[model samples]
Target: MTDVIEREIKIKLDIDPSQLVRNLEKEGFEYLGEEEQEDVYLNGTVKDFRDTDEALRIRVVNDKVELTYKSPKMGKDSKSREEITVNLDNKESMIKILEKLGYKSSYVLRKRRISFRKGNFTVCVDNVEGLGNFIEIEGIDVKESDLVSFFQDFKGKFHLNGEPITKSYLELMVNKLDNSNPN
Candidate 1:
């Protein structure tokens, strides 16, 4: 099982992100962000053709995109996952790509995200359609000094102090996309 702990943070944005990312790179960090294309999902709905045991996702980077599938896992804190990602640009080709690789393509998306960490302080840039661009921070097993340092650095870059989130967007979607109630 993967052991790295995850944290969630959000920051408001006002400036051009391209220039923002370039500035971050010069400050001894790398930009990490991806776009996600999500297949329609609904809770307690019957589907013979789709797999619910996995959350299918697509991630886009600067040079290329990636196809990934994460197995559903239950944990004390929440469900965790193990993922496998491959470089590809277009998500529509995944079914054929997976067939060629002798794997299954259950779902696909076009997602863009940028994230990085300095020590235990982590930051993310996410762009999801209808949601817009967002900045997130994950303070994983961090020390007080590291937290203070990031608070200053990140606060200086963007207006922040947004709270953490426990539910993922899919979880939100399931409730929002509901067509019928489960008994």
Candidate 2:
């Protein structure tokens, strides 16, 4: 079991991914390859995740699967929180366990992520199935107080002038799906 404090700044990108990659490379950020990931978000039986501001999900990245629980945000402006993650070898059995425990699958998110690393921060450029492109800069070991400035500088380097998006990918995707299939 690994417990860590997660912090991230998310920016919804309207620009091309190639341009972002070029800018990042120009700044000497190391490319960390890419992977396709599918995340299955689950709802707790005892409480509503939205009301609690928490999340539980099983993330399947290739043959690896991880079950993660994320607590609510620690600050208003940044996505900082406590994350507990556990790796599982049997994804099918885990899914059955969760289902038997009354945790229903809420949504599934699919994305291809290109990662870059610089210092303690990992920057991921994600192309999501329904939400388009986004850039997420995250770290578990950096100074909490410096997140604002770091995000600003990172965005500045790419000439990104848009406001940062605070909503999680699951939240955004759920809302988008709901809106599209109106009853």
Candidate 3:
């Protein structure tokens, strides 16, 4: 079992990831290779996660499966929250267990992620199958007071001109699908 506080920022990018990779390399961030990740989001039996701002997900990355629960963001500036994660031995069994417990599958997100590491922060440039490209900076064990400044410095270093995205990828995908299909 692993429990930690997650402080992060997501920026929607208009530029290509290869370009971003070169830029990050120039700034001395080490390339940490890439991986394909599949995330299955689950809805609670009695509570609507959308309304509660919480998430329960099973993420498969590099043949390993992890069960993660994220609480709602606590403060205003950055997406800082408590994250509890556990490793699962069997993906199929875990899925079946969640299903039996009335946790319905909300959505599945597939993405190709390129990762970089600099100091205590890990940066992921994600190419989501349906939602396009985004850059996310995540720092574990970060102080609450430094959340906003950490994001600001990262944004400045990356020369990210777009506004920071507040919504999660699941929310973005849900909104996109909703907009595409007329009521």
Candidate 4:
């Protein structure tokens, strides 16, 4: 069995989620889900960032609160996903709590994520639920697991599942809810 760990860290981004989506497409990435994840996603993409041999995930809006569990990938056909997740509600209010807690909202496009070992954690990436893109490596790190290691190590990372992942669920919902850009 492989040693694994579970942990998550979310931050607010400064980029226009839609613009980030466009940049991802220009780099050969495409949306992977428009249905699953949680029904919040509007434009999700399976994108790899610049200057990398493999894809680096860059989602628009992830859930404000999330939960995760990790263990091992087991095998190629491992059905369990080896993950456990819990998503909190009232994101608007939670953001206020997060702000008070001192965790700065992030601005780096591909720099936001919750990492696990051996592929297991899942939740809203960019506010998209049921289905969102993901990346994972195939190894174990326990003595000192780095949160960023998930992106740094495996390099075997890939999109989660489904079709046409939204660019930004917020904007998507906004357009649907109002039919006009908020900004």
- Top candidate on TM-score is 2
Clashing pairs in 3: none
Per-prediction TM-score, please? Answer: 0.47, 0.94, 0.93, 0.25
What tens-digit string does per-residue lDDT give for candidate 1 at 121-164?
Answer: 65666665544555655564444345545656776665444443
lDDT tens digits, residue span 39-138, model 2 = 9999978888989989999999989999999999886777888999999997779989998998888889999999999888899999999899999888
Question: Sorted by TM-score, highest first, which candidate order results?
Answer: 2, 3, 1, 4
Estimate candidate 4's alpha-carbon lDDT, on a 0 to 1 scale.
Answer: 0.32
Best by lDDT: 2
Model 3 per-residue lDDT tens digits across residues 15-120: 7788999999998999999999999999978888889999999999988999999998775666778999999988789989988988888899999999999888
Model 3, position 53, has a per-residue lDDT of 93
Each prediction's Cα lDDT score? 0.50, 0.88, 0.87, 0.32
Q: Whole-model lDDT, candidate 3?
A: 0.87
Backbone clashes for every candidate come to 15, 0, 0, 30
77-110 per-residue lDDT for model 4 (tens digits): 2111244444556644544554565433322223
- Report the Cα RMSD per candidate: 7.0, 1.3, 1.5, 16.0
